[model samples]
Target: MVGRGTILGVLGVLMAACGTPQRQDSGSESVEGRVIRPAGLAFPYVKRPACPGEGCAYGTWLACDTVSVYAREADTTERAFYLAREEPFQVLAGAVHVTRPEVVVVTRPTHQIGFQESGVLFQQGDTLFVLDYIAEGFFDAWYRDSIIETEIFWPWEHWYPAKDYEYGGDVVQQGVASFWIQVRNGSGQEGWVPADRASLASANSLDPDPPRCPARAE
Candidate 1:
């Protein structure tokens, strides 16, 4: 039998429950993260995902799912920087693993199923929050939304876009986006990494070990 707690994307559940996306305030650091990716290769930070050719300030290499940030000024020089392999960096801006209570809400009513849901509920303090969600019934994909506002974009003109970026699902498929986290090391050097390249370190994690997520409201 399907569990009653089945959960799933951006909706009222997102606004109603998880009000306002978590973000680092101007000049105020919030969540902490680390970059240890590109795997065997040392992590690469680009001046901008704008590598038009080997002529770019950082030289041609800004391809794949890379992340970027708005330079306080428009200085495009010094585009790329390679960090020490497997070093810890601070997430200037990124998602934090938060602990909160979750509940299921039916968003769409169907003939076969009682309802369809796009998000799950969670609580912070006395307020509620929601995380985007999906199931395998009518939708093959989950998480629908735009990253244009979040500075996460895919298919930089410099590099080849992902072959499967189109992704399936008409209504169910969220708009395409590539996520990269803005990070800074101890030397105050800041760079961007594809979401996959970074890892959350305990030194500055928002949540403690064995995250105590809030319980579902009965």
Candidate 2:
């Protein structure tokens, strides 16, 4: 439960919640489960849509059986933040705790989960309109309906087009292309395997996306 306070003051209230359940782990923060709703904040609107069938366009929100957990402040360059399962957090001044990792745990009046690590937290806010940004940006720049099939008829001449494009003139562009290739391949394969193929097995198991997502609904 996010602790009670005004929207502007909730930020400071979170800091106080840090030391509430005073535990003495050298690196662990305090966790006091004080629940409070933000003043004038609207109640959460919960929606659960069925999984898409054969040709239905995938909805922006996906379902999750377990609470979704992520590294706090993923946009930041620092990598020191990570949250634990059942970790308590505040959203719109209400406190909600994740019961399991990687599942979608719905908390209202915010109707979303916040991954808190150290002093920072990360979650989708309706105000960001990030999905619109992604869709627009993807279609505007990255999306290509037509397949770009480049036949390497002259592999000998352009086997390493990237090098030629960047440093063929004189300076060496360094060998980060290998890193990028690895990243691209890794990202494409980053999904859960079917339970039959994996060590765990369950029918109601969740995918990587959050369940009952309220962020992209606007």
Which candidate number would show the highest TM-score if scored against the true structure? 1
| Predictions in order: lDDT | 0.25, 0.17
**What is the TM-score (0 to 1) of candidate 2?**
0.13
Q: lDDT tens string, model 2, 71-137?
A: 2311123333222222222211111111110101111112222122121121222111000000100
The Cα error of candidate 1 at residue 74, in Å, is: 14
Error at 119, model 1, angstroms = 9.5
Provide the lowest-lDDT 10-residue window in model 2. 175-184
Highest-scoring model, lDDT: 1
Clashes of each: 18, 14
lDDT score of model 2? 0.17
lDDT of 2 at 157: 17
| True lDDT of residue 6, candidate 1 | 17
